[model samples]
Target chain A: MLGYIIRRVVAAILVVIISSMFVFAIFFLGPTNAAAVICNQNGRCTQERQALLEHSLGLDQNVVPAYGEFAKGVFVGRTISTGPGAHYDCSAPCLGISYVTKEEVTELLKDKYPATLSVALVGGVVYLFLGCTLGILAAKWRGTTTDKLLVGSSLIVSSIPYYLVALLAWLFLVNEFNLFPKTGYFPITDDPVKWASGLLLPWLVLGVANSPQYARFGRGSMVETMSEDFIRTASAKGLPRNKVLFKHGLRAAIVPIITIFGLDLAALLAGTVFTEKIFDIDGIGKWGLEAIPVDLPVIAATVLVGAVLVVAANLIVDILYSFLDPRVRLA
Target chain B: MTEVLHAREPQPEALPTSDSDPFLVVENLTVQFPTHDGLVQAVSDLTYCVGLGQTLGIVGESGSGKSVSSMAVLGLHDEKRTRMTGSIRIAGKEVVGASDQAMRRIRGKEAAMIFQDPLTALHPFYTIGAQIVEAYRLHNHVNKKTAKQRAVEMLDLVGIPQPDRRVDDYPHQFSGGCGNAR
Candidate 1:
């Protein structure tokens, strides 16, 4: 088991490295010139200024050498020359300075990441619990009015566009009804109450929007699980009705649901662009969106971060699968 | 004179037979499904009886309602999808149209079924020991340790080696031939 985990971890690191390289390559090959972007940020983009910008940003060098510098920056610390002799010391695992803000990309990401994580974590828990509960209820009450109502409602909700639902939530729940306070992000350390209130709307919007999909998945898998022979065996064991549905049936149904949940949660953590944008939260998602075109370094960092998050989530899911399903042998 | 005599005479109620009967009896059981195509008859007018200490082997070809009939005996079929007629009695207790609560009381404790495929019959997420323990704990008033002991005893009874150690193992850890039975 230890060997298997080690092998998996190694493979996950390799995937992150390869994906980061791809993101780096794409940034260099793209139409937008990093040097021009930097020069443009200075309120002027003359040819002389562009050339100077290219030299300072080290973009004038070949792509290979530039990539080498980036790679070195990740392993050891690198000094970033703002202009002439002015330099800033960027610590290890540096992602370079943003061309627009001249701030360390890593530092910026660190500042903004907590908000995104808060939204995703809270929203993920709500949706998973709500979806699975509704699904289990539907499955246990199959063919009854309650089952039909839940399934129908889930189908209807899933059929609608997610962005629209989020938009509607903001419009009615926050703006019109004044059900929740103004949507924004506040650091929890500063004021816990403000932090909770500020993020409540986004959590609801994101959780409710994502729940229908989970509900549908849960219902389908649950229906299938109910028909499994083990379910019958469990029923035949004279287990209570609740135990048959929850213990035996729902346990099997949760595997596929968790797989979907891992990927969804990872994506949300990396960036919830719509949720953050609609709610005006200064999260990593909003930051990444704003950085595009003007800041290649931040965009590249976001890509690498996204890849790492996805890989990590998948690894967690695989480990969880082994625990949930004894039939699956990791080795 | 006849009317006066009838008024004085008392009647003996002819109640259904009690106590002296087979352990399980299925009489004129018919199961049918109405699909979009048509009404498909799975089992037609099937009748069978099993006494205590009797083993009945239901032999039939594929699609001949062998599994269907047995599943009906356990009340495993989906009530919404299939139409069932007639009666299934277990030790003189009516199985057909029994409430879910009643079925739960009688199912594993009074009558149980050994499924055809062990691989599919056993829950993959649970260890064989945990599954067996759960089954035993459901019908019996036993704690975790006692339930586990019962599980081990059951495993040993099924010819599994090292029942104490094997109780910790999962279904995948067992060989293919160890068909799951309870």
Candidate 2:
């Protein structure tokens, strides 16, 4: 057990290391050019100004030294920069400062987390339930009109780009029917009801758009699980149809259903830029777009936030397997 | 479905409490499943009885309808694709074709079951204590605190000693002989 745990933990650490390396490489590749471009843009060109920008962002230093300093801030919890906006620390355990904001990445991320979490969470719930229900219905009504209609509808919906669908939903539902808020966020603490209502519109739209995959997967899983001997045993036991379906069949089919949940959350959150933009929602995806160009601190912070969200979602999926089925252990 | 159950030596205590009080009786059970090819009669005219307190060991090769017969007793399959006609009584209550509300009242409370694989059946995202409490609370009207305590008790009962210290540990911590020793 200890060996297994160590191995798994090591693997997770390696994944994080690799991902962080990728982020570092991408950011480093452009820093020098990026500084030159930004510093010189809309101003009288001067070597002194460009030098100032390079020095401020550490573009003047070698990549290894800058990485070392970044590593120190991340590990030692010590601030490297101590200036006006530069007071934002790049201490240990910290990702770093944004080239634009000169603020600590963590602070910027903290402000945006709720929005990302909200969109992803609501979208996940909506898509999962709708997709599973439709899938089960389609499977149950196979060869019937309902089944055919659903399959056709699912195919059509699945083919449409999510961004396009979000726009259409915005045009039809928000603009015409006024069935939902145009878009924007309402903090739960400020007004829970409004926050809930604000989230409802996106959830419905995202759910409708995202449900096709769920329907397909759910139907497949249900069909497979239904054939399992245990399901038959449950039905034969004279357990009512509901118990047979929910308890036995649903339980058995859950692994596959949940397998997609983490990915779905990540995708929905990432996709929310379009959804939020269409609805005028003030979520992180939209925030990312709005903050870019002028606010580098917010950009890196937002990316870190997204990375954290994705990682957390993955962790959640891993733990869910054991509860869904005892057959699986941490190993 | 675990296929490993038959290998387990039958325990004297696992036997039904008595023949008089048949815990479950499945009679003349037939399940017909419609497929693309045609309808397949999975289980035909199957009959069995499990008395209270007895774990009636079911042994069969794949497709022998052993598990199907059990599912029939529980009514845990979809009705559209599968056709079932049978009489199943649990504690003198008829369940074959029973309503969902009725079955919901019985499962986990009147009759609780454990799956073969611990990892899949259990959600790894949550601590084992949470899921156990959920199973306990689904049938009972207990507060979260009480339910969690009961979960710990069950964990200890299930051979997890020092439940207090071990309860907070995630499933990963106890995967192999961590608490399995208890």
TM-score of each: 0.91, 0.64
**lDDT string, candidate 2, A235-294, tens digits:** 333355676677667766768788787767876665378877777776668877876554
The sequence of per-residue lDDT tens digits that candidate 1 reaches over residues B12-131 is: 222264777788889888888889999999998899999999999888899999988888887777766877777778877766656667777777777888886778888877888888
Candidate 1 wrongly placed segments (more than 4 Å)? A41-45, B1-17
- The TM-score obtained by model 2 is 0.64
DockQ in order: 0.66, 0.07
Error of 1 at A318 (Å): 1.7
**Cα lDDT tens digits for candidate 2, B1-182:** 13222212222222334447577887777777889898888998888888766778889899998766766566565545567775666776676666666666667666655544453444344466765665667667899999888877877787887887677665556765443321
**Fnat, 2 decimals, each candidate:** 0.95, 0.05
Model 1: per-residue Cα lDDT over A1-331, one tens digit each: 7888899999999999898888887877778887886777668689998888888887787877888888889899799887766798999899999888889988999999989888889988989988888888887788889999988898888888878988898899899999999899999999989999999988887777778788778988999998888888887777876888888888889889999999989998898888898898988888888888657789888888899999999999998888877777799
Q: Residue A262 in candidate 1 has what lDDT?
A: 91
Model 2 misplacement above 4 A: A1-6, A77-93, A266-271, A290-299, B1-182
Worst 10 residues of 1 chain A by lDDT: A35-44
Please give, as one word, the docking class of candidate 1.
medium
Q: If you score just chain A, what TM-score does every candidate get?
A: 0.96, 0.87
Top lDDT model? 1
